[model samples]
Target: MSDSVPMTPECYARLQEELKNRIKVDRPKVVQDIAEARSHGDLSENAEYDAAKDRQAHIEGRIAELNDKLARAEVIDPKSINTDKIVFGATVTLFDTDSDNEVVYQIVGEDEADIKQGKISVTSPVGKALIGHTLDDEVRINVPSGTRIYEVTEIEYK
Candidate 1:
């Protein structure tokens, strides 16, 4: 019944830092801007006031969203887990059976997924295929190009 989602320690810290900035810096700046705009005059016709209000709304909405995610986050430390099998937060190295190339990818939460950084979402097809698999396990996944096979070469918690 919990809506908690898995998050890395780094990811949690990043979220906390962003929330702190929004609350401590961005929020107060917007308030000051609104105050300055209000002083300029008419409530309905003030474009600066309206713009400030909209910015405040966006900042507040983002703050709330970040707070909610932080509250529901289940921080999973990679170092805390000791397993040869691939799981969430595990860095996996695989050898492409078809391309004869090797690739490394870290299984991360959806929010931290960046393919260019070698981080893949747990919900992704490759992540799903790699999960629960161990070294030497042959994995076959169907891609748009066709079926591709990979041989798990390594799994690291760090």
Candidate 2:
């Protein structure tokens, strides 16, 4: 897809580092492994060679994916965003109306989203509903389970 991948500055740096490691460190190591496996015996019955080849393919695919993502990345710095409304990279606290519990989530890129860490992708249901909403705004999100209603309580950049 030609659509840009939106990410925080931190996420952009992390992806760049991973791409470098895959190219400079992992790529060479996989190549050497393949060479060693090929030297062992005939290719028809060499399990090591097959496995190494598979690993090499995986590495190459990942490298290509990383390159494409980096090329289309649109990095946004959370600290530099100045607005009261919810946006990408905003850490938001919401009061769940049904459960009467407060939940915190950080709006982040898809690559950086971790539910356990309270980070949600900007394209997610909750995140989509929270976008452009300000403190005290009531957001209704339609999730897989059912509909969820939440009140915006707090929003932080970092």
Candidate 3:
């Protein structure tokens, strides 16, 4: 067993879909490629065979990793969350006092975090600072560049 992975139901479903595709589609294609490459000529000089073998290894490794993550998944539904304070699956709007700009970020699991998409991992510095804070709370976070100050303006579960 491994440490439990906290993720939204959507993220869990996406992982399951990826696992299914790898096992049912990618695995067979790679196997066929390997067989075709083997029929070409000498193993030592066959670049296609080596490439196919490498692809097969990568696919297998990903399959195992996805299986482990799915097995240890702890799915959290955003719609069911009810809290005044910030927590997992919370879409938070922060007002940056220094830049005088507002930014929205959704606190999500590591696998689902995408800064460009306004999703931040719960373990991130900003996310850690925002946790347990209610609306209008001032949060100061330290990043790689420097320190930043933000005021919580809005909090939404969905």
Candidate 4:
């Protein structure tokens, strides 16, 4: 089963920008590098040619991956989301039960998850458990670190 990728407007824009950069700038550079490497005599002993070929393959793979993701992306504007409960693109503030400290996390797409930035993927254990939950609700998530619980103190769409 394929999962839908819910992306913020900014995330969608970033994906489009990445696709443009790969196709217009990086692809041409790789092709040129490969051509230059090809001019260096025997293909069997040419390290430059092999490296260039490898780089080309990597670039192609990334382009395809980005393209597929963009095609399947479902862009959602945070400002348009309802503010009653936690949802995609909602910024949630929670108090960790174990640590007794406040933590903020923005529920985002899987591709946009960055723990250091406090963006959690919607498919993540905590994010999944938090979805549709209202303020003051306790959420229990089973992570690799075992069971963890957090109290939702606030939910904001902006």
Which structure among the candidates has the greatest lDDT?
3
Q: Assess each prediction's global lDDT (C-alpha) against the native.
A: 0.94, 0.94, 0.96, 0.91
Q: Per-residue lDDT for 14 in model 4? A: 92
lDDT string, candidate 1, 10-85, tens digits: 9999999999999999999999999999999998999999999999999999999999899999999999999888
Question: What TM-score fits each model?
Answer: 0.89, 0.96, 0.96, 0.94
Counting clashing residue pairs in each candidate, in order, gives 0, 0, 0, 0
Show the colliding residue pairs in model 2: none
TM-score of 3: 0.96
Model 2 residue 103 distance off true place after TM-score fit, in angstroms: 0.7
* Model 1 misplacement above 4 A: none
lDDT of 4 by residue, 39-144 (tens): 9889999999999899999989999989888888889999998679899999999999999999999999988899999999998888899999999999998999
lDDT of 3 by residue, 1-158 (tens): 77899899999999999999999999999999999999998999999999999999999999999999999999999889999999999999999999999999999999899999999999999889999999999999998989999999999998
58-117: candidate 2 lDDT, tens digit per residue: 999999999999999999899999999999999999999999999999999999999999
Deviating ranges (above 4 Å) for candidate 4: 1-3
- What is the alpha-carbon lDDT of model 4 when measured against the actual structure? 0.91
Determine the C-alpha RMSD for candidate 3 after optimal superposition of all C-alphas.
1.1
